[model samples]
Target: MALLIEWKSGGNRFMERCNGALEAEILACVEGIALALHWTMLPFEVETDWLTLTQMLQSREKDLSASAHLVREIRRLIDGDREISARKIHHAQNQYY
Candidate 1:
């Protein structure tokens, strides 16, 4: 399973490029995506519009660790596929960053 980390800013029109929701919800979305993929490596990719989510995953904090662990579990499940990568893809032409 591939993990996609997304950051949704709380209902800020100026920050429209980001999702307007709590971090947990965004993380849940990532988990859901992983489950959908059945923890398969198979060249999977995760994408998020915000850079913060990506950076958070790299942090050493306990909270961050849990989230990262969830993602890692998915990776381990699909160990053989070994083609996972995450990147930011432009939402819509008019969408924010």
Candidate 2:
């Protein structure tokens, strides 16, 4: 479902596992950030292997995809709250992290 790992010096960190829609995982990230990173507005960077989700988030478009609703939820959480960004990277790049 969802998991969170925090480092003494890193503030709050998390890793989530999802076997269903990829958008759910993205939603988890949004929720996690909102709850854990609660404070003055700050920029948060998220890396993902799902290029489609990333594109949707970056473009602020919600349509066609099953995860579109979740994407919209993420956008809502990010709206006027935090600068949350999603970047696409190869799966291999995140394998060891």
Candidate 3:
């Protein structure tokens, strides 16, 4: 599943069932980011709930974990431009009943 939310404009949402582990689904979501946003929309920042992703993106050394390729791809996109930035932010807690 992929989600895109713009401040002023409306957002887009997508859902796709994947036959793999959670890591694989995470990779799918990360990969979809590039396609979700436009190239000309550089100098933009993405606030994420996942602190690990934020750390991975900001890290200089490549992450060689199971999601290495996924992280590497995201790093490539971040490196492709100069003004792009990503940071970890607290997300609202969800209650699972």
The candidate that wins on TM-score is: 2
lDDT by residue for model 2 (1-97), tens: 2232331122333446444757555765666657646753456666677887678888944466766666777777777744556789797865532
Tens-digit lDDT string for candidate 1 (1-97): 5344343333322333333343553555456455646644345555566555555543445554434555455445434545655455554521434
Ranking by lDDT: 2, 3, 1
In order of appearance, the predictions have TM-scores of 0.41, 0.60, 0.60
RMSD of 1: 8.8
In what order do the candidates fall by TM-score, top score first? 2, 3, 1
**Which ranges in model 2 have alpha carbons more than 4 Å from their true place?**
1-21
lDDT of 2 at 70: 68
Best-fitting candidate, scored by lDDT? 2
The number of clashing residue pairs in each candidate reads 4, 0, 0
CA RMSD, predictions in order: 8.8, 7.6, 6.9
lDDT of each: 0.48, 0.62, 0.59
Q: Could you give candidate 3's per-residue lDDT for residues 3-67 as a string of tens digits?
A: 33433223344646443554553564465466545544535666566777778778898587777
